[model samples]
Target: MFRARSRTGATFLALAALVVSACSSGSSTSSASSPAAQAAELAALPEATPSALAPYYGQKLRWRSCGVPGFECTTLRAPLDYARTDAGDVRLAVARKKATGPGKRLGSLLVNPGGPGGSAIGYLQSYAGIGYPAQVRARYDMVAVDPRGVARSEPVECLDGRKMDAYTLTDVTPDDQREVDGLVDAYKGFAEGCGADAPELLRHVSTVDAARDMDILRAALGDRKLTYVGASYGTFLGATYAGLYPKRVGRLVLDGAMDPTLPARRLNLEQTAGFETAFKAFAKDCVRQAGCPLGGRGTRPEQAGRNLKAFFDKLDAKPLPTGDADGRRLTESLAATGVIAAMYDEAAWQQLREALTAAMKKNDGAGLLVLSDGYYEREADGRYSNLMYANAAVNCLDLPPAFGTPEDVRKSLPTFEKASPVFGEALAWAALNCAYWPVAATGEPHRIEARGAAPIVVVGTTRDPATPYRWAQSLSRQLSSGRLLTYDGDGHTAYGRGSECIDRTINTYLVRGTPPTDGKRCS
Candidate 1:
């Protein structure tokens, strides 16, 4: 299934497995510096970022009234390939809802709720612009700029709706050689479509480039430094920004933070295990309810997982009708994606239980189809958004493919299986998507030492599924002035997801320029 780099109000963060060690490894990462030292380092950097990037920083943004009330939209232009400025420019879409003030203005609070593909502007308009706490909203302007190749920013589309439907139904957990070949062919086809659709742009959507674009946006907005809250994959983006322009980092909140050092394989494995953790939590709660689909009463969570696996197997042998009108059936891959999508947010657990009951007991796959469709941004009208396409484009370009081929995946099977016995096989195969990527990778796994930045708050949900808690810990330790904010909870992200304590702590940092105590714990 097309992995949905989900929207704002949603994501995945895992509870990272700790690697205990006693001694310092080397010299690259040292101890934290005081705020004064950090600021001095930041200011000591050149006023002009680089001789090559002068045009980008000097470019102007012409904002005009557009879309919803109290908001303004603007078009930002940046070099399509920073190295080849003579080649052309890429247009970026930006939107901002100025603060409704009772409190003094606090420049801007740029918000990105994850997804290399998630629409930042959409998040600002639908959620952050209005849903944020009034006191914070009253001061900081809620701003979002769609990263290059995202929604409203010349998005990259791979497969059409019909082709995407088939791709999603393609069996990922191949049982035989034929199924394995089919899966490989599907991956090849997807990569080919993406290349054909945006051959030039596809190669340029790497996270590092996107970080550079954010810096240009910062200058265009007339903000000397950037203040941002980035969740899930957005954490990686923000961290990249800090790494690129530590001197320009004002206050960054990396919630559901990603560890920049880990390679793709480990990240996938950890995230798979995170899904299992979330599933167990869902299972424990499901058993207490009446008519629990997987199990009831004293049923163990492992048994529930097995029951779900059995259902997936059945769907694999014979796809269930979803009455999708488009004639799409609920296949094993899509169902797994849907089930895992709910694992990102506990709030969706009840609906997940109901959907499971319908699929497992009532023989209706419609509920599961709805969930899968939502994940892929497939509308009822048989149209699709560019979420999945940009997701792969950016993911594939940011690093080398997770697997080189089906054989490589087979070799990694045991580790993935260990990561999540229930969902491991599909996830292992899912990582193979980038194996057939058309564009060569532009970035690599590296530590983001945002050394000279301000005291950035790193929030880690205890049981986050996409970005693990340990990642937050790792990131906090990496930044020179990073402070850790712990949320003892399950879910992808922490801030504004129902914790008054986290809200207050982060709000204090954003509104008052005060950093929360390092290693501060909040439930």
Candidate 2:
């Protein structure tokens, strides 16, 4: 998922997470940190940094004024492969906005808006740098680092614009063997493209590596310990940091947290259900509104779901025409993506409704196409960003594939369908993309018990589609010092999404080292 950039401060992470538990350290059994696991978890955390990475830890940064006013940017070199630092190097992009403070300066507060591939520098320059609370900014520098293989960092490339356009439309809800073969081919072609365009980098962008980079950034910034905020996939990054360098963790806030303990199929299935939860919320509100095209007054949510599913089925059979000069039609893949994209935040519900109205009622598919393009970051000139590519890349490499073969997917269909009948098929098939990844996975499902870490605040949205709320609960439980702050509302993340309760609690923790009361609920 791309950053919900429209809302300032939402430089929080967005994107589906790997479902399986991992023993890879960063995403290792990290969904929840239970109190019962505290003693055992502390005993289990990785015993501190290895000797091979000392050079990276000792490296320094050279900062300078960046493109954004009031912010500075710099490049730092890290080993492309930590296992072999003498082999090659990777340049990480960093940005920071110094606090305009009356309060005494604390330290650098590193923020990562999670895409796993999200541009942390871009987020800092555009949102978090200026958008965070004034007090926090006054007391601490807001820093962002585009993890290696993302944005200004040595980004990983997979497909050309045209090739990707075809790739995106490849059907996920394959109905027959031929469609399944085509889907398999699509996955193969994408994997091949990445291998061709970024052979060296593809194998190196795992979350564990990124967490190590964060420690390097912390040392470079002169911070004794890391103080940070991360959302969505960023949560996993933060959790991993604590796992690897538990002693180095400072005040950390994980918003829209991900539970890495579940496998990809389980993650996808739960996300489908989470989206249904958000949809029901939207549907309930939709029925009470005027001009609600999905339904009339008091129309049941089940009926609304059926109507939307019917629309998707119609698009599968005969895509509706869009106003694109390229004569592109709204395929079922695009339409389904557009629908699920809105499930990230309630802010997009209005736009989604309008798009749905045009496509389903008026047979004009342009609005829905716009939503899909925005999600994919497609430009007017037809180019695409590397978001989806890296999303697949990192996810595939972080853990084993969700389904090894179509037969495995076929076997799992009933369970996925049972998870979210409407979207089970697409989500299940989407999980297959990583099955054909060129690289072998480096991690496995396992729990993260950052045993010696300080208090880390974990936030969750009740109906977050990408990172389910239960993930926050699970992660908070698993962490040795996790404090679960529940946002009893919708949206991908809680902080900066119009909740004074959530913001104040997080701000207090960040500024005062005072973790919120565990199990605190914010509306």
The ten-residue window of minimal lDDT in model 2 covers 6-15
What candidate 2 gets wrong by more than 4 Å, as runs, is 1-52
Candidate 2 residues 1-523, lDDT tens each? 2343321111111123222222121211233533234322323334565677777777877789876779888887788888888879898988888888898899999998777566778778778888888889989999998887877888889888888788877878888999999989988998898888888898898888888888888988889899999987888888889987888899999998877666665566676677778888888888788878779989998888888888888998999999898778999888877777777788889999899989988999998888778777789998876666666667777877767789877877777776676677776676666677888888755567888889999998888766778889988988889999999988788888899999999999989989998899999
On TM-score, the candidate that comes out on top is 2
- lDDT for each residue of candidate 1 in 1-523, tens digit (9 for 90 to 100): 1121323211111011111000011112212422222321111235466777788889988889986888999999989998888889999999998889987888888888677678899888888899988988999889998888989898998888888777777888899999999988987898899899899999788777788898888888889999999877788789888887888999899888877666566667766777788899989999999999989889999999999999999998988888878888888877886787787789999999998999988888998888777776678888887777777777777766667777877987887788788888877777777667898876666666677788889989888766668779888887888999999998878988989899999988888899899999898
lDDT of 2 at 269: 62
- Predictions in order: lDDT: 0.77, 0.76
In TM-score terms, candidate 1 sits at 0.92
List candidate 1 segments past 4 Å from native: 1-47
Q: Please give each candidate's TM-score.
A: 0.92, 0.92
Cα deviation of 398, candidate 2, in Å:
0.7
